[model samples]
Target: MAGRKITKKVVKFLKLYYFFLFNIFKLNYVLNKQYKIIFLLLIPNKHNTPPTQAFKKLLNVQIVLNIYIKEHLGGVIHELFYSRNS
Candidate 1:
């Protein structure tokens, strides 16, 4: 991509990725901290629900904060679906 000529479609793809992939990596960095901040999704009876189901339930109720920059913030969803193993 550096030395060769790229078509307009490829250029658009690269631009989109370049702008978005950085925030994706940053969000992964933050969400990966969930294991450390484990209390946010704590339930009284861990065994009452299956691990994956409990994780899915938490995802539905909990909001993920995404602060792209100082003034820009919103929820980043895993709401398509979520699962975790115990």
Candidate 2:
């Protein structure tokens, strides 16, 4: 019975983890699309100035977010597998 309870808990944890991971990926995709749209819209015409510093900052933010997501997913996977083995 105790082993069954542990199995249920592991199953629940996996479900929640996958759900969270899915949302993160979905959010990343949406954000990337938005960034592309914004980049296109910000492009200057022949008579106009280039995109502003604010857009450069936004790009930096996107890079950081991507790095963070990668690290977070790696850490989560490591913890899940490590715990399973122990």
Candidate 3:
């Protein structure tokens, strides 16, 4: 029973991973080159959620941090743009 549950989870994760990959291919024109970096960073092991939700959470945090930086740093914020691909 426990083994069956584990198998189901593995199957579900593979489905999700493939689904994201398919969407990534379909949206290639719309995706930035840095996207694969984000995707790779969220690859799961023993203690993480799937990449899809993890990437969304990362974006949310990034947005909040950008807002905070702009508010706190004022004009210097314009020079703070950093490229992840760099």
Candidate 4:
């Protein structure tokens, strides 16, 4: 009877150990998959190339034009409202 009890305890301990081991392996696989996805997203592909020098210059010109237009419009409105004629 004592030997039977010892065998039962060993079996139970092995079951618990294997259960935890399987779960750990599953978690590791899931984390590795997520890491691979994140790494792929972070790497710039051909479709996501950085802007070229010409594009950067064009963007700068657009920004400057936007600023100039806003300032010019503000000046025109100011003159219309605060002029000596009004």
What residue pairs clash in candidate 1, if any at all?
none
lDDT of 1 by residue, 1-86 (tens): 64443364456556655786788768756775673357444665656666777666555543443333312321222221122211
lDDT of 4 by residue, 1-86 (tens): 98986686567556655665666556556655665566456555566666474455545555665566557655754564457334
Query: Which candidate tops lDDT?
Result: 2
In candidate 2, what are the lDDT values of residues 1-86, reduced to their tens digit?
A: 98987897788668867778878889888977787677666665554655575568667868977898779876986687668766
lDDT of 1 at 24: 73
Q: How far is candidate 3 from the true structure (C-alpha RMSD, Å)?
A: 22.1
For candidate 1, which ten residues in a row score worst on lDDT? 77-86
What's the number of clashes in each of the models? Answer: 0, 0, 0, 0
Ranked candidates (TM-score, high to low): 2, 4, 1, 3
| Deviation in Å, model 3, residue 33 alpha carbon | 17
CA RMSD of all predictions: 13.3, 7.2, 22.1, 30.7
Model 4 regions more than 4 Å off: 1-51, 84-86
Pairs clashing in candidate 3? none
Q: Could you tell me every candidate's TM-score relative to the true structure?
A: 0.36, 0.47, 0.31, 0.37
Model 2 lDDT on a 0 to 1 scale? 0.76
TM-score of 3: 0.31
Root mean square deviation (Cα) for candidate 1: 13.3
Residue 20 alpha-carbon offset, candidate 1, angstroms: 0.8
The alpha-carbon lDDT assigned to residue 6 of candidate 1 equals: 38
The CA lDDT at 68 in model 2 is: 83
Off by over 4 Å in 1: 1-6, 39-86
Against the reference, the lDDT scores of all candidates come to: 0.50, 0.76, 0.54, 0.58
